[model samples]
Target: MTDTTALSQTETVQSKADVVQVTALTGSIGAAISGVRLTNINDDQFVAIRTAFHEYCMLVFRDQFLSVEEHVAFTARWGEFGFNKMSPQLDDYPMVLPLSNRGKSKAVTENWHYDSTFMTEPPAITTLSARDIPVGGDTMWSNQYLAYETLSPGLKAMLAGVRAEFTGTRLAKLYGLDQVPRCLHPVVRTHPETGRKALYIGKPGDTVPRFEGMTPTESEPLLRFLYEHSAQPDHIYRHQWRNGDLVMWDNRCTMHYAVHDYGNEMRELHRVTISGDRPV
Candidate 1:
């Protein structure tokens, strides 16, 4: 009989070659990658894609069309997939979190915040796929590192010794948590992989307190100023999806928001989060 194993190996390599293609977007914001069906990527191809993702910070894969299992498996190829401890849409697949807002079901993720920052161990990466889309459902992402880099040297100097406190209690109030997360992160943190500093201050539930030597009243206006200036369009990219598209983004240096114009037509997306190391 023919060596089926060799044939399978050959087929996999051929499939990967036929399926993978990468395209970068404008303003150093995002990339549009095509080919290499996620469910069937090989080890070598996966490494290449992972490298591209790190360089791009955000990658958009068109024509994924993965089932929940395949979607979770594809995300697992990059890193450990974390369970969703917040949304009620989680099912038997603990690692798969569904993001949908249909009819009376309100959509979450309306603000610009890093996912699961309340935890002592926050996620490193997050993968999302569109299942359903309304006529105008779109997602936007902003680069925090770029935001910090563009700041005036005077402000950057002022912020050098400043830090902000993030509390789970404040976040808990927004999400209706019985208990708050037990971790705190620096307002400015350095990325372990890239060794770049970024503003790590935006979350839906942040309670701004004085930075030790500074008072709360003295800190709030500056914090708000940084928050507003950091989210400017020069640092933002918006993704308008097509069916079967998958996106994976670095949570360490990016923040995202889901647009609300989809209305009642229904939008379904699945997310898988990768474990993250502490910021330096």
Candidate 2:
């Protein structure tokens, strides 16, 4: 039986050559990775995966089917575990949070925004392992680097010294919390590892109520425009999730929106976020 199991594992690795194969999903943001399993990735494969992640900002690994322990282990390769006080975790695995449609009154993630931006030190990376998936429940991600790069020189100059106030208003409301978590981050944040700048704006009155030192009314119009501009079709990649898929994104450089079209269909995924430095 042990020999047979060993043979099976060898055959599985041999079939895929144990090499990482990355294919760009779009011209802008995401990549689809194949050939290496998340359960047992080698040093070379990890280097290649990390390189692709830096270039693409998001990655999709199909047929991962990772267990809670496997998910946490894979996420730790990126960094320390980032806390999400708003989401409940599994009793056995504190770092793994189950994202389900069960008893959810509304989908707070339907808007394009970074994960846990209200935190002083927000998550740098977030990975979701699909447990159950329903048709029509695709998630979309926008390229924030392109969002900043495409702006006019004058607008860029004006925003160079600006900071925005990010609040956990939607998440707070969803979780029925009285106090909202909030923080101030640069409007255009520089990536610590890549040294690239990304627009860090969120939807007005949703996650970002206003720019620092500015009233909500004064910040609304420009904030709305920037939010809309960042989410243009040319700058986005939409992922149609499949069961057993593990998708990870750089929360520092991308904004994601979860589509709730699969209503009452019981879609669920396990999430693990990696902590990052405070946005500069």
Candidate 3:
């Protein structure tokens, strides 16, 4: 099939057990599934949805036109949500976080990094729904599992006991550290649920002084190398969002960046995070 026509297949509605699994991109960590809607999901249907999310690490539901209240209600089924401290649009629905690069608010994630990893306890899962889609505004998510597993075994072994601080303010400064976050996380993190090892290195400006006992100069190059390699093209999936498209991802195993090529066109999205006990 032609590249453009590949994902053009009409999504078919079906029963929960008969859900269709269609790849959004050739080798990405996410899948666009058909046959279900989140707004009025049943227990069994949600189970299947959660299963798909765990296996794929990310899941996208298309053409699901839902109201703000309905979207927030649906995401709450996954877990408790958080408010967006920097965005004022979340004023109405305190539980939902608004991600907008419009007249009123700036985009929350314009760089590559995991969501809220700077916090002592980061979000476990995040569900984002598009309210408006402007040209050139896309979101890209990277599979950290694949990124970590692809490294040479020797390198993996070297990173076994390593750790680094992940500060949010520093990451925001990549465009300039003018206004950045301050917090720390391990350089190598163990997934709370999956128990798999992942490289949790740089996020824009997160400075890596050292890994365990290494010197700053000694560790900088290696950390930088991994940070660059982890977001390779092969492990990435760039989604061109549409209004009503809902994308959910496991923050424990993924990093995302927003594409801001759409200069003036307004784009808005809402995110609800699922709380986890803690990072393992």
Candidate 4:
């Protein structure tokens, strides 16, 4: 007689490898997922994908070049789609926002940041679907959970109950917006799902003005350290995007940098963010 218990375990492991294969792209943050298509995935596969997204903080699905409509549809499964204030939305699909390098002197995403932090409720999961790819417009993501974990416990204790100011000054200037938007968020935010703490420092002197009323002089040294430390090379994974890649990251626990070494060539991408609650 077949040992059904051992047989079931073997089948389960095989099924997982068959359904989706997630390979870590870096020791710290991003993972590449194969054997599944975003446009054509079942609920069980999606659950596995979401689990992988949270575990790795970012998931890169290669060759998913989904249509604009299809991209919006797949992302909507996560939650309500947030409006992207930086660009004009597609006429048919309001959620489809473009991130093209067609008319800009510099890309706003060159620095590391959490998306839409100026809002009280910034989006949680941000998915970017590659439209057009230049040779060197790679993006990098860092794990903020590791950033906070690796910090000295003394510093962690000191940051308790600390809040920082987040602004859109640089991005607003890049887009020629009239007024910059800003908000206050905890310095160390706890993830709602995983219960892990993540350092929420923004680009110093840019988005993060100062630790709430502590003055620039008081906050500069520590804020700069946190910012610099959170983005250490060992804490990051850089993605050299392919023509059909679809990458998604958790904004609550990751900071991503968009590198623009490709000049004057067409580099386009579409992004949709799922609304997240206020950081506790």
Candidate 5:
């Protein structure tokens, strides 16, 4: 992990004294934020948090045992709520979805994917608060910005302005739905906040059906390469979940895979998503 202080240009000298401590989890992406509480974040602290969020693409807060109300409130600070229709929501708190090993045939997130990319405007951010963690339910996130930036000039030019069809195939299968939800988004999309380009492709048969104006056969090789290249070990940060841990990732700039190694030990998390604009 790389240790660095996060400071915004607009930060005052006094604000600097209270700035949150950010340590990079990996050379490529993610940071661990300390010295602040999400329950009662002041304006200055929020500014620093936002800075670390945009720069790191994912933030990890340890030892935050947030209630459903607190989870919703902190997530709303990011943006409007983006609900997941396929997942079961909490009875009283409809916006919070419970992710558990109670009644699932298989783990839907074992493969890497951006959250709800099938939507016309997929979620910009997703936050998960660990409720009941087992021994090994770690999740890994890959940096999509680095994915796009590392591509060759020719491949980059080829992908520029290209769009792909994203589908909710895995979730559809998991829930035994009749029809899958699908949408078209740019293969490489520019982030609205940071103005950096990120590879928007996914595991072809799983989340992505094919590139627009191309047949499945024509798209397979390139899609496979991009998906594999985007998730190289160097560009990823594997987070081992601890009890009372709350993690948030920018879905627009990252893809995450959930490891299901804990078996039936009962791992549960409360998840909240923030809505985002349509991909341009």
Candidate 6:
């Protein structure tokens, strides 16, 4: 197979499972899968999908168009559901969170972030089902593995034992809340599954603010550098949304940006997350 649209076969265990194909979308982070439907996935298919999920931090299932119930059922196979604390879930089902352009407050997701990072135990996986995509509402994801791996030896060594304060400031404002959640997480965290390290900082004073025990003024420069360095073009993939698209990413190893260029045009997505343990 050629390298443009599909992945060259490798000696991975998933190759032994079934005919399901895992095609790498970008050189860095994502892959597209085919052959097995999420609604009727078999044990062998599930094994193949799960293997790809670990090997590639993000998986894009084009034209899946899963219903809210089906989306919840698929997420259940990964782990316990990670509920949103700020936004109310879709009507009756508390596990399905809705993000629509009509919801003015949903703009908080426009920034680059991992889901629920302020929580002591942030989510591991986040699944989004796209609908009514406008012309320019594309989303971009970056590989944190590259962010950590490409850092200078000196910088990586400096960040080894440091922790930073992650806060829900921007989200709190969107939700009209007073008390935002905050927690300290290692500046460089190891992904429990892949055992790869990632830079855990986001937009400095916004999502994360200062290193633990240091004043914001002191931690400003380095934190800013890491955030800026992490999104270099080679390590990123900008996903143009399509109707009925399903994208699931490992929150532990990737950070995503939701573009707000759609203006007044309509865009809708339902999100489901799988709970993860505290970062190591």
Candidate 4 backbone overlaps, count? 0
Q: For candidate 1, lDDT tens digit of each residue in 29-88?
A: 676766677888777778767666666679888888999889888888767877766656
Estimate the lDDT of model 5. Answer: 0.88
Which candidate has the top score in lDDT?
A: 5
The digit string of per-residue lDDT tens for model 2 on 185-204 reads 99999999999999998888
lDDT of 4 at 146: 87
Tell me the tens digit of each residue's lDDT in model 3 across 1-280.
Answer: 3111122233333445555544455354777877667776778767767766665678889999778888888888887776545445566787786766653245446667787766677778888889988887888988888788778879888777666656665436433546655455666678866787666865433444456555666777887788888799877889989898988898888888887888777788887887765555
Model 4 Cα lDDT, one tens digit per residue, 1-280? 3211111111111244347777777767777878887888887788777877777889889998899988998999999999876878888888888888854466778888999888999899998999899899999999999898888879989999999999988778877989999899999999988898999989889889899978978889988999999999988999998888989999999999998788788998998999998998
> Once all C-alphas are superposed, what RMSD does model 1 give against the true structure?
9.1
Q: Candidate 3 at 195: error in angstroms?
A: 2.9
Off by over 4 Å in 1: 1-20, 102-108, 168-175, 203-215
lDDT of 6 by residue, 102-147 (tens): 5444688787788888999999999999867889889999988888
Inter-residue clash pairs, candidate 5: none
Q: Which ten residues in a row have the lowest lDDT in candidate 1?
A: 3-12
Model 2 regions lying over 4 Å from their true place: 1-18, 102-105
Write down the TM-score for model 3. Answer: 0.83
Specify the highest-TM-score model's number.
5
Clashes of 5: 0
By summed lDDT, the worst window of 10 consecutive residues in model 3 runs over 1-10
lDDT of each: 0.72, 0.87, 0.71, 0.85, 0.88, 0.85
TM-scores vs. true structure, each candidate: 0.84, 0.92, 0.83, 0.92, 0.93, 0.93
Which regions of candidate 4 are displaced past 4 Å? 1-18, 102-104
Candidate RMSDs in Å, in order, are 9.1, 8.7, 5.3, 6.2, 3.7, 3.6
Residue 150 CA displacement from its true place in model 1, Å:
1.2
TM-score preference between candidates 1 and 4, better one: 4
* 268: Cα error in model 3, Å: 0.8
Candidate 5 lDDT over 17-40, as tens digits, reads: 586778788888898888778898
